[model samples]
Target: MDDIRNIYCVGRNYRLHAQELGNEVPKSPMIFSKPTHALVETTGQEIVLPGNRGEVHYEAEFVIHISKPYKPGMKVEDVVDQFALGIDFTLRDVQSELKKKGHPWLLAKGFPNSAIITKFRAFPGVEACKEVDFSLIRNGQEVQRGNIQDMLFDLETIILFCSQHFGIGAGDIIYTGTPAGVGPVTDGDRLQLKWGEEILGECFIRLG
Candidate 1:
């Protein structure tokens, strides 16, 4: 079995999502982890759940794919050369329950297809900056909107922090975290994750 590397998530990345989660203006970015298998690719694929959580919530997060390994004392600029982005889906109900018990949100965050992502193509001339407009349309109605600029932690910071614990190497993908307005996804439902004019990708829900 492929040993899952790491599931890094950012909290209160988006101001609006922070408000929706009832969080105060954060002093620093809150981070967490899900299982590796939780990842889902949005390129013409479907999301299938393991039924561990009651409601599989969707969080449209900006993902990062590391292009190379980082050396110790590496500055953000050093690894800034390699940054890719994607989405991080969540399980709200299970996450909430775990919070009540002061538990780890492993099960809630790490389920099959819990993390939805698109291919990582180099984003150039953006100053390690991102301008994104993301929404998940269910039944043809826009349900979520997240802009990358709204993220509390930018690519540099996220990559810097990530390297502290893990050696970011080639093919290492990071789901930056989500924006607010998260909701449930059911079987037979189709989801669209779009970034501005380009459609990042889409996925359908299939119940087992």
Candidate 2:
């Protein structure tokens, strides 16, 4: 395993997700985080859900790969050059449980292989990065669907808000929020993410 520098996950960036989670869409972007070590990055990798709360959900996020120092007053235009696509896997039941108890999401987000990210590319322009159509198919049928525009927090705002309060720097990654329609993935399930006809990448969840 490699050492991860930092992990940042934006919260409630999608109006629908906020509404579904029973939170009003924020006038500004909300933020949360996972341990960098929590990132899951193996092709055909597997994830395990705690048997006690057996609901492991997948949250597809836009992964940003930084190449420069991130500081206060930094603009997305400055760091926009480094970006990619990925998934922010979450335990829906676990998160809900934690929320009820007013706990931070460390346990909910720090499990091994919790975050799965696909190979990133610069082919797509960053300004309207929402052009991608995101969908997750479990087994052979469709399960979750979302589009980039649905995000309540725009990318530029994300970069600015985070840098304002954070001592961010180069080589950091930010898992922007996921859209609505998130659900659980059990062992022996296959997950796919796509942008138009091009198959971005796919991952299968199995035993940890």
TM-scores for all candidates: the values are 0.82, 0.86
Model 1 is weakest, by summed lDDT over 10 consecutive residues, at 76-85
Worst 10 residues of 2 by lDDT: 42-51
Residue by residue across 25-117, what tens digits does model 1's lDDT show?
Answer: 677667777666776556666667644557766777666555567776665445433333355666777778888898987767777766766
TM-score attained by model 1: 0.82
Q: Residue 80 of candidate 2: its Cα lDDT? A: 48
The residue-level lDDT of candidate 2 at 105 comes to 76
Residue pair clashes in candidate 2:
13-152, 40-115
Runs of candidate 2 with Cα error greater than 4 angstroms are 1-4, 71-75
RMSD per candidate (Å) reads 3.1, 2.4
Best by lDDT: 2
How far in Å is the alpha carbon of 35 misplaced in model 1? 2.6
Candidate 2 residue 13 Cα shift, in angstroms, is 1.1
Q: What is the alpha-carbon lDDT for the whole of candidate 1? A: 0.66
* Steric clash pairs (candidate 1): 13-152, 40-115, 61-177, 63-85, 63-86, 64-84, 65-84
Off by over 4 Å in 1: 1-5, 50-52, 71-86
